[model samples]
Target: MKIGELVKQYGVSVDTIRFYEKQQLLSPSARSDAGYRLYSNADSQRLGFILRAKSVGFSLQQIRELLLIEDNKAAWQCADVKDKVQLKMQDIRQQIAELEQFYQALAKLDQACCGGALSATECSILTALEQGKPAQPETHQEDASC
Candidate 1:
């Protein structure tokens, strides 16, 4: 298929497909007489996998490792894949904890604000920011929804 067909089929921009080619993630299987790139069904499948991996926050390097494993499955172990997923999960959990801390701090600062007819210099949130106040500790009483 032509590059235009691929872009329309995948709902991605031409530049995105070109970038994948430049990154060595995807390659044209052949070129037409007019010098247009030609792709195969297998290439389309690989592009789909690349898009899915990116959607889940996989870096291009990580996606490359996955593609390598896909190309040579007999030489790779499932344990290696599991290890990478574990590391990603750990990073996500740490990020969530940090975000929760930030949320608490922002909430405290917002509550402290009087919202009166005061200038920015007199704002409590601004004063707290100027003083470099630390984030508040999380209260860990479990909620049913959580």
Candidate 2:
């Protein structure tokens, strides 16, 4: 198959495929007698895995590691893939904890705006922001729903 058809099949673009090739993520394929690059079904599968790995927030380095395991079938035949995935899951959990903290802080600030002067300087929004702390607030999820 040609590069263009591979893009259609994988829902990516020619530039993306070319970039992957340049990154050494995709191996160079055979060229036709006319010198056009010809891809095989394996190329399509590799591109698909790259796309899926990216969708789940795997970095290029991580994807490369996965590809190495995939190619060898031994890197993961034991417990290496499981360990790597466990580390990624731990990182994701830490990020979620930080995000929840941010969400709570923002939700807390919304309470100050409920009853305060309407002017910008006197505005609870501006005052809280300038002070970098809430002046006695209650956190609620509904406050941020809007």
Query: Each candidate's lDDT (Cα)?
Result: 0.84, 0.78
lDDT (tens digit, per residue) of candidate 2 on 1-146? 98889878988889998999988899647998998889888888999999998898788888998899988895466578888788788989999999999888777777656543234545556677788867455243433411
Error of 2 at 3 (Å): 1.7
Total backbone collisions for each predicted model: 0, 0
In the order shown, the candidates' Cα RMSDs to the true structure are 7.5, 5.0
Among all windows of ten consecutive residues in candidate 1, which has the lowest summed lDDT? 137-146
In model 1, pairs of residues that clash are none
Candidate 1 has a TM-score of: 0.84
In order of appearance, the predictions have TM-scores of 0.84, 0.77
Look at candidate 2 and give me any clashing residue pairs: none
For model 1, how does the per-residue alpha-carbon lDDT over 18-127 read when each residue is reduced to its tens digit? 99999999999999999999999999999999999889888999999899998898998999888888888898899999999989888887766655554656565776
